[model samples]
Structure formats: C-alpha cells, structure tokens
Target: MRWRVAFPGICVLLLIAVILTSQGERHVSLSDGVVAYFKRQQPIFAEKTVQLRRHIEQLQPGDSTSLLAARQALRECRISYKSIAFFLEYFFASEAYVFNAPAKYEIEEPYIEYEEPVGLQQIEALLYDPQVWQHRPELAAQATVLVQTAQDLHALLYQFSATSAQVTESIQQELIRIMTLYITGYDAPLLKSGIAEAAAAMKAIDTMLTPYQDLDKKDSIKYYLQQGIHMLSTQPDFDSFDRLSFLVNNALPLQRLLLNSNHDLFSATALKKDVFPHKDITGDTALGRRLFFEKALSGNATRSCATCHQPERYFTDGLMRNRSLTGNEVLPRHTPGLLYAAYQYSQFWDGRVQSLEEQVKAVMHSPQEMNANDDTVLHRLHNMPNYRGISLLQVQASLAAYLRTLAPFNSLFDHYMAGNKQALTDEQREGGNIFMGKGQCATCHFAPLFNGLIPPRYNRTEFEVLGIPAVDDLTHPLPDMDSGRLAFFPIGFYKGTFKTPTVRNTAVTAPYMHNGAFRNMEQVIDFYNKGGGNGIGLSVPNQTLSAVPLQLTPKEKKALIAFMEALTDRDPIAH
Candidate 1:
C-alpha cells in the first residue's frame, strides 16, 4: 500500500517537471528566431549582389576571361538569393518580382508594358549572348538595378516580424513552390540548375524551420528533412531525379508533419486565412457569402455567379457550354466547376489569370459572360437595397473568398485514405489501384487532389497537349482547331494544350474537357484508352499524353469511373 502511494506521487512530480520544461522552451519565441534568421541572411544577399555588380562593371567587351568571371559571380549571387527565396517570395512578393521576371513581354490587348529584365537571369541571358557584349552600358545599368533591388530587400527584412502561423504557412508554401517551380525548371528555365537549386532550397528550408523544432514531434521532422536532403543531394541530374518518389516518400510526409506541428503551436482560428500574403478575403465571413450570390454585381438582373455556377449542381451550370449573356450563343469553353478551384495556381481554361480576384474581374468584363466592366458593376451593386455602397474591389474579394470555401476535400476517397478502409467498396479500391498503377493516371493527375497542380507542393498547374479531337465523332478525327494554351502563350508546343482540370467532382461536372466535347466519363476514358488523338490516326507531333494504348478492359474502365465518383466531396456548402 505504501509503495503504490509513493509511485503515484512520483508520477505527479514527473508530469510537473515535463510541463515546466515545455514552458521554458516556449519562451524562446519562434517569431523572434525567424526574424533574426532573415536579418542574418539579408546582409549576405546584399553583399553577394554588390559583388556581382562589381564583376559586371569589371567586364571587358569581347574578353572571354572577363565574361567567364562575371558569369561565375552572377551565378554565386543567384545561389545566395535562392537560399532565402521562400522568405523573400512570401514577405515581399512585389519586390521579389523586380528580382526575377520573364524577359519576354506581350505587346497586344492585355498590354503589359514590359520592363527591362534586371536580375541574375537577365545578366545570365546577356553573358550567354556574345553579341550583347557591345551593349555594355545596358548590361551595367541592369546590374546597378539588381544591386539596388537587393539592398531594398535587405532593408525590408529589418521590418519583418513573423507570427507562428505565418512562419509555418510560409515554410509549407515554399516547399510546394520548390517542388512545382524549382524542380520542374519553371524558375531557372535558362540556367537548368534545377537539381542543385532544389537541394539549396531544401537546405534553406531546413535553416528556416530550425526555430520550430520544439513544436515538432521529436526527431520525426528531422528524419524527413535529412532524407529529403540526402535524396536531392544524391540525384545525378535534374531529368533523372525521381520526382514522384520524392513527393510520395519524402515531401508529402514532411508537409503533413510540419502542418501538424504548426497546428500544435497555433490555434486553428488564427491559421484560417489566405495562405498567400496580400489577399484581403479569408472566405469565412458572412459578407463574402452574401456577395457571392448577389445579382446586383451583374449587368443582367437575373444573372449572377450562381447563374452559371449553381450550388445545387456541384457549382457547374450542367451544360456542354453555358449560354452567353444574351442567351443566344454558347460561351467558348465549358464552365469549370468552382469547387476545388482555389487549389489551382492559375485560373481559366487557357490559364490567362493567376489570382482568383483577377479571374472574377475577367469574367465580369467578358462580353459572353457577365458583360459588365468594374465601374458599371460597382454602380449596380451600390444601387442594390442590401449591397448599397459596395466597391468593385470588395465584390471581387468577397467572390474570391466564397469560391475558396467551396474547396473542401472531404470525399469518401479522402476518408478511405485517412484510414477508414470501409469508406470504399472493393471495386473502388481496385479502381484506385488501376488509376495509380496500370492506368498511369497518377503520373499526370496526381493523387488526393487528382489535378495537374501536382501534390506534396501544389505550387504550379500544368497544361498538357492531348491532341483532343474537335468533336466526339472520330470517323475523320480532326485535331481541335481551338489552339488552347497557344492562344495565350503562342508557343508551338502549347498547341491543343489545356489546363488539366480537377476530377474531384467529375461525377457531376459533366461534358468534360476544356471544349466539353466528351459527353460522359466513358467517352473521356475511351479517348485515353486508345492513346489520345495521336493513336486515332491524327498527326499530333507534340502530344504530351503517351501515344501507346492503355488497353484497359471495359470492366477496368468502369472501375476507374467508380473511383472518380467516390472522389465527390461529401460536405455541403453551408451558404
């Protein structure tokens, strides 16, 4: 009896000690630690920028030795900047743009007045072109601009103060961004240092995440980080790196672990905002929901967002293509379901816009859609009895917010993946296996989200050249004349390429593909089973989809459809 009483007392003492120890560790402020890290990195980046500028200045026209030295210096500067890419991109997006943007500019309708390229990439482009050596003044001017930008970025770091949520979100976002952009060669298209750069990015993330170590499961996160670093380090080259394996084995697990750690450190309420830095809407407000369904924002009194994206019909109008504003002609593309739309990096069938708000603005002004400019829409909204004095920006923000709320991944398949095995039938399970393994669906569509955005990171959306037929009739199979992504990018490889849409709610969002040519899931599957348009005797030289026939049995095709149907989100939109 005495021994039992003594053991209980000892247990209480041990519990008390653990609590005190945790409290002591908590006092070390994660926010302060992150701020200090950036402070240290800021000066390093600045110094490198200065060094690169000096190298550019020292360059002698047509001298190969001078050119090589300058190129090496510029590469060093880029490497230093890449280490803090996550922090710079998250905190100072606009300033980050000044550091690196595409060199090319469009001169037509969507008229972006292209600024002179002025960063490491611009310098790299100049160094590679022997002819550009004659334009020494231009090179020096761009180098000066890069130095100033770096200095400005350093100064901004002084004002940086991270909340626990922001730090966690930023790290998570950067991981995805690295996977989507860095690994895919989107960021360093010219340099082709994707492998080395990805490793550097992972190392930087390791440094940034060091402060939150106490919040993580002991040794759990460290294991994944080390594994990721090791895997990336050992890779021979960018093309040979097993991206799928890395995402499945290392990155996805790490993301979940970090997310859980963040959840443990911060309240869910605090973390429930835009993951991006500057967005105004949180999508949790009643005002946003009201604005989403409001007709006053439209030119036609009866038409609103709900007119095309009906809530009862899984957010699609349930048409091959929705009728135009006048109801006389059909819109160019099928109305993509807004459910899970927020998860995508770009918006629209052609991916013409980046932000959700920007997409709203585009739709509102399109003559075939809302047919109302910002000014006219705002005027109508102000005159509404319930929405008096609403600004155009507010309308856009609210709509974006509401659209984001529609993206809840609570499907039966999600439940099955979360460990409730009974959530899926035997056929559905087989279908999933076929989808992931034999069908080669996961290679492009990815898992969980099952979209081209790619998982573990979800940083970029992919457009694919499928060589889709213009119509369902394959008798004389003509390639779709509607140059999909080529309309925007005007590149030969982008011909017939369309943004890969999410299959989350494919059971309902019918008449699939950008053109809504396929009437059912069977038709869509048949197109893929026979190896896309190329296998059907159409001359598609740049088809991204494999021309080799899948040879999936009819039963296998039915099972695939069953699995997709299971992906339908179970949760109802509260509004």
Candidate 2:
C-alpha cells in the first residue's frame, strides 16, 4: 500500500522534469544552417539557364548544340505520351505509401506539463494536431500514426521552399533519417527541435522584396519546396519490353491521323470503309503535331527524327553522313525515306527491328544515333514548359501513334487501283507482266501493299538470304558479314536471311540490298541473271536465294527499272 502511494508521487516528479525539457530553448540553427543553403543553389540554377539561353541564341537553324537541347526538351515533353503509368505503379503497385505515419511523438502533446526538447515537441505538436487526426482518419485507423508523422515532414519540406536546395535536401534527409531512427528507437528530439525553428526563419524572408523579382515574377521559395520534395519522393523502375509494350499498347489510346493536306481524301480514308477500314484510329490528331514535327522531339539538345527522315525526298535526311547526338558520323546505314513504311512489317534493311515505334526507340537510344537512354531523354523533356503533367510513357506512345499515320501508298499505281486505264505505259505494262512471270520479282515482292505479309500480316516476318556483296568484293564474298535475320535469331536457318522489303519506292531508295551494295538497277539484274549470290564467290551454307537465274537481256533490265520508277508517287500516298 505504501509503495503504490509513493508511485503516484514519483510520476508527478517525472512529469515536472518532462515539462522543463519541453519548454527549453531550441538547439536548431535556421539562419546559418538552413536558409543559407538555398541562397547558394540559386546561382547554379541561374548559370544553367544562362548557358542554355546563350546556346539557343547561337543555334543557327540546324546546328548541333541547339538540336541536342531540342531533343532533350522533346524527351521531357513526351512523359505524358502515355499516362500516369509510372505514377500508378508507385502509388498502387504496393500497399504502402512511400512516406506515411502520424503522431511523430505519440504521447508528447504540449500542455501545462512540458516535454523534452521544446523545438522537437513543438514540431511533434504541429504534426500531431487534432485536425491532423481528422484529416488522416484512414491512417489513424491503421495506427499509421508514425507514417503520418513522417509524411508531415515532407509536407513541411513543400511548405519551406525558402530554404536552399542544400538546406532543403539536408532537411529532407534529416527527416527521413530521424523517422527511420525513431522507428528504430533512437533518441533524436534535440536535432528535430532545432530544425523547426530554422524552417520558421527561412519562411519569414524567402520572398522577393523590391524591383528584381518583378521583371521575372519570381516564384516564392515554397514553389521550389513543393517541386523539390515531390521530385525527391519519386522512385522509378524500368519495365521489361514485354511488360512495357503491354502497358503502352493497352493503357494508352492510339490517335491515328492523315498528314495528307487533302482533307477530303483524309476524311474518306478515315471514314468507315469496306475493305481497308482502320479499327485502330481514334480519329484524332494532336493539335500541335506539325509543331512537334518541325520542332524536333529528341529531348536531347540535338537532332530530330526529321533530321534524318525528311518529308521531302520521301522522308530521308538526304545527307551522306547522318549526324548523331554525340555529334559524330552515323556510319554503315543510310537513312531510309519514310515512304510507305506503314506497309512494312519490319524496319531497318537488316530488319533488326519489328515496328516503327521500336525503330524510333532504337535510334533514340543508339550511341551512333540519338546517343541517349530513356531516362536521360525523359529528364530533358520534364524541364519543358508545355509538358507540365505528361509522363515519359505517354510521350513514347504519342510519338508512336504519329508514326502510324505515315502510310502513303498512293502513287500512279494507286490510280490504277482506282481503275484508271492510261496511268501505265506499254513498257511498264510489259515489265509488270514480266515481274509477275519470268522476272519473278513479284514472287517475293507481292501486290497491293507490295511489302511482304502472309495475307493480313500479324507477327510473321519472312527472311530470305539474298547474297548481294560489296562492289569491290565480287569474287571472294566474306563470311565476316552482317547476316541480317541471323543476327536476331542466331540459328542455322536464319543465316544470311533478311526481310523482304517493299518494292514500292525502290526507285528512290538507291544503293540497294541490306548493305546498300548495288549502285544501279543494271548491276542488280546482271547479278540475278547469273543465278543467286552463290553464282559469284560469296556462299553461305544454306542460301535460299533463287539458284535458277533470271537470264535477263539489257532491254528487259531497262524495262524492269522503268516499272519500278513508275511506282514512285508524290509524298503522302493517297489513301
């Protein structure tokens, strides 16, 4: 009975001690420590802005530096190309929030009795307000009081933009560290108490005072606070190609449009039709697609896809050496003009890629191409003004949807499809017959779209080994060769196999074959006339090219070339 009575007296004595500590002076430094940090970071941001502006000023239309910057901007702009894909994953893929808890110091509410370390207790009081309990009922129910308390620190960060990044980052780190420590039973009340005072002081003076901020309308320190804290909270993980593809193809809407200036035909083509109606079209175009096209989408400070695939000359760069983001020569392959590529099931001469979007991704990330990765490109895009809420996945999907509208098969040949009689000449007619018969070009290059397909083509991509060697090496063909489809599959069957390309714009896509080996139509015919590539010295183990020769005379060769030339139409083939 005496021990129980003494226990109450001991509790009262301890309560007095707690009150003394709770009302004590703050240990935290605001001026010298927290506020001083952001003041220093301002110049770094300013310098970066200045350099980019100067570089833009120096950009002469097609200069490399400007192009790189534009590329970066484009990459940033495309984050919304999908939706909140990454956001959804971070938000819902897991059951827990990145930071969530409440009641930082569970029982230590300020009252007549004091708590240890006045600054820390004040912070805890702010975090553990009765309003906070009401505001976060869901958290409170789960006893996520600690989580709410931790999250409140991030909220404070957003509110405390007056601090320098160094200060902001330091405070953020401190909050996270303390939360972890507190969770692990560490004593850190003094450290936190001091930080609360620092926050109050910075919030006091972080606004623009007089004349300078007026010209630029500078944002309050809080703007940086929100942005900085939001940025720090985000964590990214790359999805696999299969998963990424599924997410993109399913989650995002594909907007198909007609770049064709003729609105009537575009309307007719886009309209519901019997044979070739497009089920994929959402019947929309980006209001500013032409802006994107002309502006360059690389997101690096460099070249656009248009830099290579120009609309004129059938969508090629029309340059011998394609410049890469690293400002280096892109060796090996010439840029294929973007004509009738919609008919192409495979992309690249070696057919290394499967689709236009995949091809774009390849070029964007290639060291000798755009010389960038997805994140590097996306970071550049995120810095832009117009791209405020867009995600990286959205941008990729948008760009891809744009590419889908590049189908222009309409030439004089399309006129023939419309039942025009005089579009073909006698020579072209005779050559067409030969193409179907003895010429045997039509055996590989089929009709309608002329690109290879297995009648309503889906996943099937065909590869035949056509041995067309370098001009210099006619006699001894080197096996130290780029074996096309063999590179992708790496099997006995795939050796020397390359995809069969559409003969549609064959006239303009000069220097033919996977390696761009042949210079003229005559050379191609002459080689074919002597049977397959094995007729020369270069022989693979299982060559599927015609062992039987075309045996064409000079006239037949010229006539066949004429037929190919007639296949050329104006850019943006009429639907």
Candidate 3:
C-alpha cells in the first residue's frame, strides 16, 4: 500500500519536472521576429511613398491650398520613414544616404561627380520655402527622386536579416544617435520637426521590442522606454526644451540599461585603420618619448615637434601663430593643441589629411613648417649613431603613436558623467545645463569629446561655417578672408568653413578660432552671443552658426566658461 501511494506522488513530481524542462528548453528567436516586423512595415512605407508622389503631382501653380497639402504629405512621409529609422540607418546606410544625405558633399569624394543634393531633405528645402513656387519644376524633380528612393527602401527591407546581437547593438547605437543628433535638431535642421520625428522613432522602438517582452529585465527596459516616450511627447518648444534633463535622465540611463541587458551581444566592430597604421608603440614608452622630442626630424635642427607643442602650456605653443622653420614667416593658421587630436578622423584645419602620420609628413615637407623631405629626414636620422637604422616611416609611426596616447578624457566633467555628482559645483553644473540647453553648445561640440566627430560611430569628422570675424572689433566687422575649406573643396558654401576643433583644453589654449582672433574666452563667448559674424554685420551668406542671438546673461556666460574650464584634463605627462 505504501509503495502504491509513493509511486503516484513520484509520477506527479516527474510530470512537473518534464514540463519545467521543456519550458526551459524553449527559446523565442528575436531575430526572426524582428525580420517579420520589418517585412510588415514595407507595405505601409510603400503606400506612404505613393501618397507623397500624389501630393507632389497635385501641386497647382501659385495655389496656397495645393502647396499646404503637399507640405502635409511630406511631413506624413517623414513620419512613415522615421518609424523604421533604426533598421534603415543600420542595414541600408549607403542607400539611406540617397534618402536624406546632407545637402553638401565633401571635395575629397572624387568618385561622386556633380554632387548635387538629392533626397527628402532636398525636397523639404524647396517645399518649405516661400520661393518654392518659383522653382516648381526643380521641386517636382526632387520629389520624384524621393519617391523612387522610398520605393527602393521598401524593396530593400525584404532583404533584411539580422542576428540578435546585431539587432541589440543597432538599437543601442540608434538610441545614442537619436539623443545626440535627432534631438539636437540636426536631422530636421530647417523644418524644426525634431520633436515629432523623435516621437515616431520612439514608437518604432517600442513596436520592435514588443515581441521580446518576455525576456529578463523586460519590465525595467519597458519602463525606461515608456518614460522616454512620455518625456518626448510632453516636450515644450524646440528652443526651451530641457535637453540636459532629457539626456542625463531619460536617454543615457535607457541606453545603459539596454546595453547592459545584452552585454554578451556587444563587441567593438572593426574600426577603419588610420591612413598610415603605426606599430604598437605607445607614447608612455621611452622610445616614443624620444621620437616625439627628437629635433633631427627637422631640416634645420632649431626646432622639434615639441617646439610648437610645448607640454608646459597644455600642448599648445601659446602664440597666435607659430613661426616657421625659417623664422621669417608665420604658419597660416593658429597652432591647434595636440591634447585630443588623436580622436579625430582627419587632421589639419582644412581636414585634407587622414592620419597623424600623414599630417607629420605634410608638416615636415612644408616649406613654412619643418621644411624637411622624407629623404632628408631619413639621412639626418641615419647620421645619428643612436638612430642609425631609423627610417622616415619609423619616425612617422613613432610620432603618430605618441600623439595617439595624448587622448586623456579624465576631466572632472568626465568623472561627473561616470557617476560622481560632486565632480561639479553648483555654478559649474548650472553652466553645463545652459551650455547644453540655452547656449546650444552641445549641438556642435557634442558631449565628452566636445568635438564634431558625431558619436555612436565617430568615423567621420565634421566641418562648420562659423563666419568668425576678420578682426575682434564687432562694430567694424569683416568676414575672415581665409578661403578655409574652400581652398581645398572649391565649393561656394564651403567658403570660410573650418574643421570643428576640440574645446578640451581651451582654457589653457587661448587666442581661439583658426585665425586666433579672440584674445580671451570672454570675447569668444560675446561673439557667439551676438550670433557669429552675420549677426555682427558681416556678410556671410552660408554661415552655419545660427543668426539669432543666444541672449546669454553675464552670469550664464560666466557659467559656460566655467564648464569649459572643467573639461581640462589632468595631464598624464608633465614637461
């Protein structure tokens, strides 16, 4: 009787164990789920494209009603496109460029002949303008191109497939991109439709992650997503929106959580090699130190690399412009500090070179700079008994290696971002808020790096047309005469454009701007407050800086300066 009772109990326990085991073995594939979701979105996007084309076709000559309809249709199309933005940007990057690339093209991109702006942005620029009626045919042509691109995007969605890791990584990157670019009004710079588009993107993310709701930590992730969407939905005006709060509270924490949940899926993708790859020699070593300070690399041994890049003054020569090797003329531009130069994709004020090694070669070969050719440099090094076997290539590699080690990101601000609240004082923290919020510094400078390398990818550097004054006097202003990027690009809009340099050690590296026109940070702040050269009565048609005054108060201006000073890195190696 006892054996019979025990057998029944055993059977019940065994059945429960089998069910639990089966449940444990079962795994829902998120990759397949996401693929299905993308496929579903294809038809919706196609229909929206058709609607956009129809609206464009319905444009009657000088009819406000028809134009209004067209604008509405265009906004609807943007909304539809934004719904699948994360997937499109990740899987179809090249094709997506045709959908909404920047209006301007880089001069270095020789493969693209007659680089005219095409895509949604091109159409939007025309449609939104009051003068669009005058250029109806041009607007119509751009609309047709947008229609075809949207169709291509729809077709391409069917070919999309991603691993779970890829999906997770792409989502994480998209979140960061949304906060950094989309929220900052970069994507819809002319339209000011950033808030609406951001909402659409958030909705899309919610939809994409819905199928994976049963995963571990789903509740917490869902909470963050909902909170972010709520924050975006309730945003005030574009200018007054608390971007600092949004970034620190909503966006950043959400990104961290998402990344942590899929820690195993995250890995560094292969970065493009610098134009000239250096051997594994870091600057902290004795050999790298020797190469960096070596004067033999110069044709005239009167100066070394450290001559212009003095370690005592935060790697800057503390001059408006450095004297040339001949000591008769000055270099064209101000000497930019080498503190965080390694993080940039391109070097020099014009962004003509691709690597630090290439920059070294250019500087050495230039008559105004070091004035040493590769052969001459090698010969000089060969004559030195200690450097007898050193080649020109080795010199380049060693110097580049040393410069790469100068990327010190450990500022008090960096520590604050990493989680130490006490890293900033009340005044500094308030100033930081204004910098990101009212001042609009974060839009161009970006975060952490305070450079225009554009995060989440950081592959390409950016150039901006600030229209800095020819002289410091605002009352009698003239545009800086340097052709700047136009010297190399030869494009009309690129005239006076310069690469955005880092403000990392700006406190120490005074005499700001490419021309070193500003004597102090106060002057720089005042210039920006007055809305760059254009606002100060200088004729700069293509000035990228906003023409509207920042209207920063004396207190706020002081705070902004304080925040910049906080970015000063603790030197890893003092002279």
Candidate 4:
C-alpha cells in the first residue's frame, strides 16, 4: 500500500518536471521554422533590391565603375532571391513572377491573359547590353519597378503561412529546380551567376531542414547539401562543369531521399488539376486497350489510334508524318511517341491542349486526324460489349489512364542511376557527360522525364524556337514554314516555337523534329552541332537555341548518340 502511494507521488513529480522542461525549451515546429526563415530572408532581399536601385540610379554613360558596381549589386540581389525562391515560387507563383520572370511577354493560354515580362532577367538583359548607356532610362525604370516588387514581397511575407507538409514539398521541389533549371543557367544566361545562386539555394534548404525531427537521413542530406554547395562555389564555370557527375552523385540522391519519404504525404496533391482522377486504373487501362485499336471509333471506320501509333514501332508509325484518315496527304506534324507523352504538361507538338482527355477530343474532332464526331464515337462505344455502359467522358478517362502507365523507368540509363554500374558503357557515359555539360542538351531536355515539362513544379511545358529548317540542307538552310505555337497564340515571341519532345527512344524513332526535318540521329546531331539553323545562316531572329556552334568533335558526337540510345526502355514496348 505504501509503495503504490509513493509511485503516484513520483509520477506527479515527473509530470511537473516534464512541464517545466517543455516550458524552458520551446519546441520550434517546422512551420514556425519555415515562417521564420522567410521572415529573415525578406529584409535581406529588400536591402539587396534597394542597393540595386541605388546602383542603377548612379549609372552614367560610359562609366565603367558605376556599371561594375551595378552589375555586382544585381548579382547580390539574385543570390538573395535564390534563397527564398523555392518558397516564393511554390506558394506565391503569380507574385513571384515579378521577381525573376523571363524577359519575354507571356500569354496564359485558354485564358489568353497577357503578362508583361518584368524582374531580374529584364534588368540583367539591359545591364549586359553591348551599349548599356543607351538603355539608361529603361534600366532605371525597371530597377524602380523591381524595388517596388521586392517591397511588395516583403509585405506579402507577413501573411505567409505554410504547414510542415508544404515546407517539405517546397524543399523537394527545390531539389528538382536545382537539377533542371539552376545548374543549367536557364534564367541567368547573361549574368552566369547560376552556380552561385544554386549554392545559396542549397544552403537555404539546409537551414529549412533543421526543424524536422523525423528526418532519418539528415546526415546524408546535410552531406549532399555540403558537397553540392562546395562544388557550385568552387567550380563556378558554366560550360565546363561536370554536371552529369554532380547530378548522379549529389542532386539525384538527395532528391530521391526527400521525395521517397514525402511521397505518401503529397503524391495525390502533386498531380496536375487537368489529370482525370481514377479509382480503378487497372480496369480502365484494360478496357481502354481494346478501344485504342477500334477502327469504328474513327469517322471513316478505317484508321485507329494504333494505326498511327503502332506498338511494334514504339508508338510511332515510322513515318516523317503519318498519312491523314483520307490517306491522300500527310498530316501537319510528326507522330510524337506516346511512351512518355502523358508526363508532359500539355499535348501535341504545339501544346494547345492541357490534358490527354482534351487531346483525345481534339484529335478525334480534327478533320485531318481521326475525324470522329461525339455521336459517332458514342455509337461505336455503345456497340462494344465492354464499353456499352461507359459515357464518352468515361471512355476518355479510361484512355488517359492507359496513357499514364506508359512511363516505365526501366531504361539502361535508369538502371545505371539505380546502381547497376555495368548498365551503361563508358562511351555512353562520356556521351551523357557531353549532353549535360558542353552539349547543353539537358538544359532543354531535363532528365528522368527528358521532356519539355519544367520540373520542381512540373506545372508548365516550355516551347523553344530551334530554327529547324524545312529541308535537310545545312549549306543553305531554309526555315520551316510551320508557325508552330504562334498559330494559336499569335505572339511574336512564340513564332517558330515548338514543344521539346522526349529524346528517349531516339534510337528507334526516326525522322525527328516537329516538321520531320532530320532523317537520322546523326543528321539531328549535325544540325545541333552547326548551332541549329541560325548558325548555318538562316534568318531566325527569335531562335532560342544558341547560334554559337557546340564544336563537338566527331568522336564526341558518336558518344552523344550512344547516350541517347541508352534511354530506350529495357522492358517490352508498353504501347
């Protein structure tokens, strides 16, 4: 009886002690830490913007000292922006666009809303102009706008609130952005401050991860961050950096670690709003497989989806451009491989449609393609025993479900990344090095997906003006007549722009480019090597691809092809 009484007294004492200890050392939640981090970064960014504005105001015609100071100040502002970029971009995307958007007018399609380009990139372009003094008024005006935007962001931070889950998601996305955008110098093309900015971003991530007590691989994460930051800081050169090695060694591992742990927490939420949410995907895929090959779905009851995207040829019809339903003339564009098409933010070479379902509707309704009306498609489905009860939307959902399953990451390169060292030959590895480094292919064709879908968020697909010629004549290249994305958007900036397709399965998929200008991979490499059509003296003013020659030797070109060949899936063709 005495021992039991003493035990109760001891429990009470321990509870009191626990309360005292908890009160003495307040536990900072991950949400609190993230909010704190943003708060801390806000003033720093604002100060940098102010300094940048001051430098811009002090500029004089042919004043090198003032010019140098302004440039340095701009670099500092960029570094500060990078530290908070992940959070700003993920949480406040519309507002953040004013911080570092591309220096080109962008139109939000479907909505057709116009957004004038502003931010750091605009200032950088003006500052780095050959005749900078001539653009002083524009420069000063942009700087003032930038300063105001920074102040706006500072005010916005007061209302910023992120859960632990959101913070973790932001960090994971930042890892992807670092790999796809930052290291490649996507935005900082002129300034070339990408490496330094990447380092700053990594350091911010290190700080952000501090409050997560459940992070089991914290040491490994810290090591990767340290190593990556060191690499970026020490070897700041853009062209010669061993980007492939960095990706394979540090960034990829770190990305996988965080993402794998957070997969269950955020996977469903990460999916695009355009995707049709399905419960029984396996059932849908099996049903859709039959409908995919049904000729009755076409208006003429002749060509099917499989007729153009045949399974034997990795979903391509082995044609530069497939014959139309009439079989009299060729289609407008090449039949893009359906293997990884579902992963992109949009469908078609021009990316007019946002979802696979929408793409299905467009293709079926098109006069040249399938040319099937809703009534015809419904009537066809009504006769089919399995699809009788399904609505047209249900049919589209089933097809999209099947499309999503095509991405099987079992390629030789995927295996190599998965720790099978012998999966890739040394020559292929060298090719990869060139592709990521001097070749600069990875800048447009990001890894894993190797498509135009911009990573971290994967919410946008990029369009590039490559200046692909009408015919394979490098000597006297004639620009393709295809207006590309400009046909729909009708913007000068979008003229000649086409979505960057996946380079995966390039070994088999021949007659590349939207217009099918290249007959083989060798021809494709030669075209890019000569610096696209612009380098070969085509009048391509809006060419996104650099006109400067890649200068790849013959041996390097072969290796590059080998690397691309390794992207072929190891398993049987999914289509």
Location of the lowest summed lDDT over 10 successive residues in candidate 2:
1-10
TM-score of each: 0.57, 0.48, 0.80, 0.81
lDDT of 2 by residue, 533-562 (tens): 777766654554544466666777777787
Separate clash counts for every candidate? 1, 50, 0, 0
lDDT of each: 0.67, 0.40, 0.68, 0.74
Between prediction 1 and prediction 4, the one with superior lDDT is 4
Q: What is candidate 1's CA lDDT for residue 454? A: 41
The stretch of ten residues in a row with the least summed lDDT in candidate 4 is 1-10
Point out where model 1 deviates above 4 Å: 1-273, 276-284
- Give the per-residue lDDT digits (tens) of candidate 1, residues 1-575: 00000000010000011111243345346556667777788788888889887888888866888888887787677767777777777678667766665332212223323344556666666666547677578778877887788777657755567665565556666676555556655444445565567777788878765544544554466667777888888983654466545655676567657655322111212122244222554433466678767776667755788889888888888888888989999888889988877766678988777778889888888888888767767777677786787677777787787777776667887666544668888778767656654565655675445777543334446667787887887657877788886788675555687878788889877888888888998988888888788878899876766666778898889988998888887764753
Q: Is candidate 1 or candidate 4 better by TM-score?
A: 4
The better-scoring model by TM-score among 3 and 4 is: 4
Best of the candidates, TM-score: 4
Q: What's the residue-level lDDT of 462 in candidate 4?
A: 72
- What is the overall TM-score of model 2 with all chains considered together? 0.48
Ranking by TM-score: 4, 3, 1, 2
The segments of candidate 3 whose C-alpha lies over 4 angstroms from its true place after superposition are 1-29, 39-79, 105-108, 112-114, 123-144, 147-153, 158-160, 214-219, 261-284, 373-388, 426-440, 489-494, 525-558, 572-575
